[model samples]
Target: MDALNSGKFAGFNLSLLKFAWLSQSFGGVLFGFAIPMFAAFVANSIGGKLAFPAGFIGGLMSTQPTQVLNFDPASLHWVTTAPVPSTFIGALIISIVAGYLVKWMNQKIQLPDFLLAFKTTFLLPILSAIFVMLAMYYVITPFGGWINGGIRTLLTAAGEKGALMYAMGITAATAIDLGGPINKAAGFVAYSFITDHVLPVTARSIAIVIPPIGLGLATLLDRRLTGKRLFNAQLYPQGKTAMFLAFMGISEGAIPFALESPITAIPSYMVGAIVGSTFAVWLGAVQWFPESAIWAWPLVSHLGVYIAGILLGAVITALMVIFLRHMMYRWGKLLIESL
Candidate 1:
């Protein structure tokens, strides 16, 4: 644990963070924003309602739209349409890979100052982006599409299993690793549904807020229970920070508390997620966007219910954690007494 927290690890984390920021920035401008803008422009110039879907898919996949143009004789109009990119998932996969690859190359290869400057500024980014986009379009897109279809099917089936089951699945997935692959997989399915203009009746959005908010509230409950002002004061900052992060749709904010006492915190977070998500689903809450933050409440179909679900979940989680902690403390005291 000490080694993991050492300066060496800290430096590595910093480097990785820098790499992620640079990659995401570059990807956002080129694929996320610019390409979609261009696609929309082209779609509009061709005179049709094709721009919305085209731009949406193009932006998601970070590629130009593949357009089909037709002249309608009755209306004397030129119409264009772009099918959703089969390779949409490739955009995310390739960008992440490219980011790490660039980092590795920068460390391993030394170029002359002029060449390095040129490559870093122009050559590398252009070539990598082009290569990734092309590969995604031609090769990876088909396979990615098949996988996307499978995931979509699974999610759709899950929805049919009734709200309770669906919410349970989503909540568990969201809480299992706290922003790890399982969480991302569930999120991807939710986003895919949104992209197709479908309202996903899911508790995932609610689950995202539960962990952090619940953990934060648990601290307050603990303080109230023990009347330990100094200890509570020390925890207050972290609790407040977690709550703020939860409002922004970040679950990782609860991670420190879970790490401190996994037995109590993890189960509490998971249960909170389940309860919140179930309530939200039962209330017919629908999320149009995959990322659900408190600020996006207006976008939720049932705004009042959504807010209620979150508060209920957070309160339940806090109480659970407080109860469990109290029990554990009592058991420890009993053992000490016996000894």
Candidate 2:
């Protein structure tokens, strides 16, 4: 816990928690309530012994066994032949719509602090529930079916290489912003793809680790290669903090580096990340779920190659930053000594 409370770690965790809490509007609450309601509703819709095995979502709800859906590819329709686990589908939509609505509302209307929280509390939950009702019977069931088909089509068209590239692209986006929306969206999309076996969790795992590790190495190498004091002052701790967070897939880890030298750090990190993600895809490292970087060892199908990808990315970023820092330091020192 102390580890979590200090430096960049504290900041990153707090940010993620804030996002997760605010995510209540995005369907976290509604999905909590909707699953049982969905199960009961579905059971009633098609009466029979349809078993919807409870998973993580259901575990949270502490609900009974529900029905799982079995879709008919021949007719492109879910026959309602069995109850399906649409709970996640229900929640994801709720989260997306709710998240967007909250963002819109926050932008359009500003209220007192109490009023804002109250409004968020009441409105988001109600809206999410309503949205779930609309989506389950009408939208998600069909949409999910479409997604399955789309995945199939992509598999047929791209074969293995193409799909791998898509995952790498997503990793690149995540690496670009760390914890920003683009990063979140890419990570979320990648996880969803994992569920369908389209992308491995390891692919994302490597992606998230790249930014911090890359930047951290750069800072370290800078101390030796160049006389630049990028990490020589108070900034040393910040770089270390970033490295720790990045190990856990915290992209915000790179924020400090960016703040210090937006002109240089940003591009160096990006290039390094691109290199890392490319290797991950090329090596075919498969992952199963999204996890903190501490769990990286267990997450990958091929750990050795995955670690190598991360190391390569780090080296590239370090070298790039070292080169730039040395140039800047030399010029600055030259000017200072002349003065």
Candidate 3:
């Protein structure tokens, strides 16, 4: 009794932490794999283009077990299946509900020791999984579908205008903040369109990778052009770290460079991102996943074009940085004596 009241069995029970882990694992399997795979099977049966990859992305965005019966892959259906809800509403509901249910049951229920052990280990998990599936199917899936439809419609309209315009807008948004609210907004919209419209997401992926990589290249070029080490360290590990982070689709890695030289750095980063994004979109490179990073490049529809776009952006940004710095030095704006 004392232990229960105080939440201590040598320490506080940390029941919430345990519950969170369980919910995440369960949700990942349901939302990330099982449902998507099933959707793909259904789509294939109907001769639809919503393949496994696209269905997986749809599941990822929806995070709910939708009304499978209403799905008509032949028509590329979405909202017809259900209405939209908040992002990841299904996952959130499932995790929270499952966690709380287990917590409450553990605290309030009592049984024989052996029975209790079995209930805790097996019965609870199975019951929770079923509950989540049913809840998502009946309530959450419709709303998620609606929201996905809206996003898809908007992006589709944008794509129709021209790849260059859409790519420039997305890339600029990403580079403007690195990983701030602007970046997140663009990312959310892009991610939601991964299944139905891959261009926006593909452009975003390219934009995400260019800034850090371009800045890293700039550091190397700066050293070469000036014939001196830019930083105190001989190897410049920060540049390497930036490149690594870029590969992982983290744009924040370039924040330090932007802060140190905002005038030159920010413009260069934006320009590079725009170029890469536009080129990738023009090449019709499609990414099924939202932010899988460079390691997932093989998943892109046009691998060669995607790589070419990345290289072009990185080279352009590096050159721009080098040129700006050289001009600054010649004009006496830069006080460094190394050159």
Which candidate comes out best when scored by lDDT?
A: 1
- TM-score for all models, in order of appearance: 0.60, 0.60, 0.55
The TM-score of predicted model 1 comes to 0.60
Task: Estimate the TM-score for candidate 2.
Answer: 0.60
What residue runs in model 2 are displaced by over 4 Å at the alpha carbon? 1-132, 139-148, 230-232, 326-339
lDDT of 2 at 116: 70
Error (Å) of candidate 2 at residue 287 is 2.1
| Candidate 3 global lDDT | 0.64
Q: Of the pair 2 and 3, which is ahead by TM-score?
A: 2
Residue-level lDDT of model 3, residues 25-65, one tens digit each, is 67545434543444334333432331223333333434433
lDDT of 1 at 193: 53
Evaluate model 2: give its lDDT: 0.59
Q: What digit string (tens of lDDT, one per residue) describes model 2 on residues 128-217?
A: 345444544465555554664566477558877776667567667777776776776565556545545655666567777777887777
lDDT of 1 at 258: 75
